[model samples]
Target: MDKDNDHGKNDGEQRLESGEGDTMRAEGRFIEPQEPRAEPGQSEEQAGTGDHATPERLDHPIIEEPHEKPEKRTTTELLYGVIANPVETLRYVAKHKLVAAGILIYVAVAWIGAFASIPGSLNSFEQIPEISGLPMFSPRSIIVFTIVGTPFFSLLWLVVYAGILHLIASLLKGKGEFPGLVSAVGFASFPMIISTPFSLLDYVMGIGISLYGLISLPFTIWTIVLTIIGVRENYNFSTARAVWTFFIPLIALFLLAILLVIGIIALFVGALSR
Candidate 1:
């Protein structure tokens, strides 16, 4: 027994000299295993699963931000925006639902302006001996015609004009829908409203049709310019494509108008000859 005790003590002394603990663990030297570090580019959730497991804890969900509303503009501002900066305004109108109000105001202004011009137009026409001889050219008839027919013709013009322009734009690979183009194109007519005051002016000033035409010409060109820009903005067309899309339909409409005038004159001549 004394020999065994000496052998065991010698073994313990050897372990201590070798910097290793004996069979029993050392007090206050217990090593705790740490969680394996998350690998590079590995998410905490992903790292926690599989080879990188850890105690599961509840995670708060991520929240999203709320959207802001668009700022409002007045009617006068809307009109001015269309006139001064049609590209931006028409694009906005193209995406908005209140476009109908703009179009409605435009229609009202145009019709009222037309009504205002009729007395002058009739006065000018009455001076023409041949035109005055017709029973249909009287002021009463003119008033009735405008009262009854203006809205229909105006809206018809709007729809047909929008449809033709949209077709041209579509052929050029433009990416706009027709309804939006209608609203945008209708606002392009807003320039005509600017000229209406001048139409009233020519009447108030008693200038003839020649001066009225002269006064309307500049505004007419401005309207066309805005229209081209509107087409470009709304349809995302290049400058050349937009101009071509605009002018092609315009040229066709002009030719059609000329043909219509010629056809009417020919019929009138035939009737007079008979």
Candidate 2:
């Protein structure tokens, strides 16, 4: 009975040891599952959203954008630009004011001198003695000659005025042909023509000289104003400059008048000697 009991106890101890060893071997074989890893150039969000596809490049040549051009002014627009703006007119005059003034002064002096000398010339012809060596022309003949010559002088004056105005316009950087100056002068002459009837009536009356003088004042002022406008239109100068430029010609004319008077005296002396 004792031997059987010892054998039972030994068998129980061996079973216990085997159970512990199996538990340890099972624990060693178990490994934590490896976590899933992401590859390079890929994000967890991209992968989740399924948007990791590469963008494609185009194979054909790229077209460049074309550049835009600037706008240009038209002819009528340029014409208005030349005439309408006073600032532009002044600028034109500032550049060529001296020449313009000189021409104007010459014209003024010539007109004044012509008017002043007319009566003296007529009287001189009337007083010409019908002596031996004198010309056979009578006072009536002389008067007729003078009257005939007036148109020629008038035409000459017109030509000179137009030519000078054109030259001034050219100096001021204006564009156009000579006709521009002619047209301008022609327009300016209108006031002078209108005043003529008044002048004739004044002559018929005893107060003709004073009345004509008053009328001439307005005519002169108008002429000067028109001259400035014409110059501004032709030369593209500002109004102020064109107005200032008038002095140039005025001074020249004053000087020319003095010279003309001296020349007349010298001619008179020479004639007396002859």
Candidate 3:
């Protein structure tokens, strides 16, 4: 009996050592090898929950930003820049309080220059005495009126110019301000100051009004050009609109004047016949 029991134990040991335990499956499939066992009271699946964590993300796209504009200039710089680079100066003047300063400068220059050049314009006037009947326009009275009323004239001009330009610009879908338009018109008048000296030269040196007019014509043209730019810039409109804004009013005034003269003549004829 002892010999038979020893033989059965030996056969069992041989079967285990021959890899029969490895072929055993839990649910009709071979068991996969696993990591070391978890701690006390912890299952392998529960331990894996602690091991899994949120990952870091870094795949977002970059975004861009806009740059800033340049700083503004001073009133003096804008004054000098008017005839030099009118568009830039008008832009500067429109956004600042420089319109007041510009209008003041124009009025002062015009007053003093007119007073200074009386001798020349008077000489020119005396030579053309063919129309002496118009005594209200004597050289002395005209000088007095200009000296006393230059500020008023300048202010009136500013209002009219700014008003017309703002209206036209608004009609054309522009987004300009009235104050800025005033500054633009005021600064556009900067070129007028240039002609003052030449007028004085003609008066003092007696170079003749023709020469003075000839020399000052370019400055007048410059003033007109600057004005056109000012209107264009302040209105933020096309060059064509700016040109029309300037000349239309003047043309209308001329037509009105001709109509008035014709009406007055017709009235006088009717009165004489009656």
Scored by lDDT, the top model is: 1
Ranking by TM-score: 1, 3, 2
lDDT of 2 by residue, 119-210 (tens): 54444555556532245455455456555665467567767766765665566666644554444444444445445455444334434466
| RMSD in order of candidates | 8.7, 22.0, 14.0
User: Tens digit of lDDT per residue, candidate 1, span 242-270?
Assistant: 89988897688899999999999999999
Q: Which stretches of candidate 1 lie over 4 Å from their true place?
A: 1-62, 72-74, 97-99, 253-274
For model 3, the superposed segments whose C-alpha errors exceed 4 Å read 1-69, 121-147
Which regions of candidate 2 are displaced past 4 Å? 1-147, 256-274
Error of 3 at 204 (Å): 2.3
Candidate closer to the true structure by lDDT (higher is better), 1 or 2:
1
TM-scores, each model vs. reference: 0.70, 0.42, 0.64
Clashes of each: 0, 16, 0
lDDT of 3 at 118: 74
What digit string (tens of lDDT, one per residue) describes model 3 on residues 69-119? 767677678777885777877877776646677677667766766676777
By descending lDDT, how would the candidates be arranged? 1, 3, 2
